[model samples]
Target: MTADGERQVRAILETRTRAFGRRDAATAAAGYDDDLVLYDVVGSFVRRGEDPTGRLERWIASYRTGIGHEIRDLEVTAGADLAFCHFLVRISGTMRDGTEVGMWVRATTCLRRQGDAWTIVHEHASVPFDADTGHAVLRGEL
Candidate 1:
């Protein structure tokens, strides 16, 4: 594993998390490739070659209060031209409907080196589900 490459990927992820907390959709979505493939926990099951910033903007706008977002247990693996990271993300905030929301989601991001920067080519975020109830387990520790 390339230490420098790992650091770069980690920095990108940390910056994105901070941007999300600040509700800066453009900055949060900046790391994604134009042809990004996403398997999100909400909304449609999959998205390909879609503008991520627009979707992020809408999600961020849904929170009436500033969002609280953090990443934990982050693990990164990097090589010359590719890298991947996995982490548990905690999101907490108040929605426009005055509902308090908080959940922990599993996330994995795959990136490709573009010149001197890395861009996320694919991302998957999901929550575990109960076997019997089929309900998502959103709140929990890893």
Candidate 2:
């Protein structure tokens, strides 16, 4: 990818992270489509609704209170105006009752260009493969 394309991809994702970590639902929702889809590996969630901003806010709040994800690596593959971003995420933090929680997962996001901007069209997220099972067991049949 060209440097500018790379920057655009990173900026898009960073905006999402900032929104998520700060519990800014509006910002987070901007990264996705109006009819966005999300699957949570940890919560076993398969959700499609009118608005997903609320869910983004709630996820951030939960991260601050009990759990959250850290972006370990983000690889963006771009084709013309489209991008497929692959993520390695680490889940961590302690709950209110002091429960330690930590794990790693893999996520995928499909983005499309909207004029000079970009937005997510489809997203499929999941946990990494297990050493024993040698298969992904998080979400979306990874």
Candidate 3:
């Protein structure tokens, strides 16, 4: 049962990642619980429920030319009705100014199972900061 749960949770993550890579904000948001809470890397405060969708749309829009997302070093654990996964995500694209943008961010997701479907209830994405310089550390290993 644990293995099956893990597989299911992984499938959800995969689908969500694919949706995000395609810049399909609606499909990506569908994987999240209606009352989802997110601590986003780019934002200063926590985002609740459907608020992240607006941020996502703005982000996709910023990459006016093209965008690509890659997930790496994913690890997942699942129980009966709960699961958690963490991974490194790389987002690369061309910005509207014709400059290339690329970043590596760490992400963690907590999921809850409702009936047979798993939905993300909590998610956090962050990039390490250089304490001395007060700058984000964007380049790193997975």
lDDT of 2: 0.70
> Per-residue lDDT tens digits of candidate 2, residues 60-112?
56554533557766888876788888888766666545666666677888877
lDDT measured at residue 75 in model 2 versus the true structure, 0 to 100: 85
Ordered from best to worst lDDT, the candidate numbers read: 1, 3, 2
> Which residue pairs collide in model 2, if any?
63-67
Compare candidates 2 and 3 on lDDT and give the better one.
3
Candidate 1 segments exceeding 4 Å error: none
lDDT for model 3, please.
0.82
Q: How close to the true structure is residue 68 of candidate 1, measured as C-alpha lDDT? A: 82
- Backbone clashes for every candidate come to 0, 1, 0
Instruction: Name the candidate, 1 or 2, with the larger TM-score value.
Output: 1
lDDT of 3 by residue, 58-100 (tens): 8778876546777888889899999999999898888888879
TM-score of each: 0.96, 0.74, 0.89
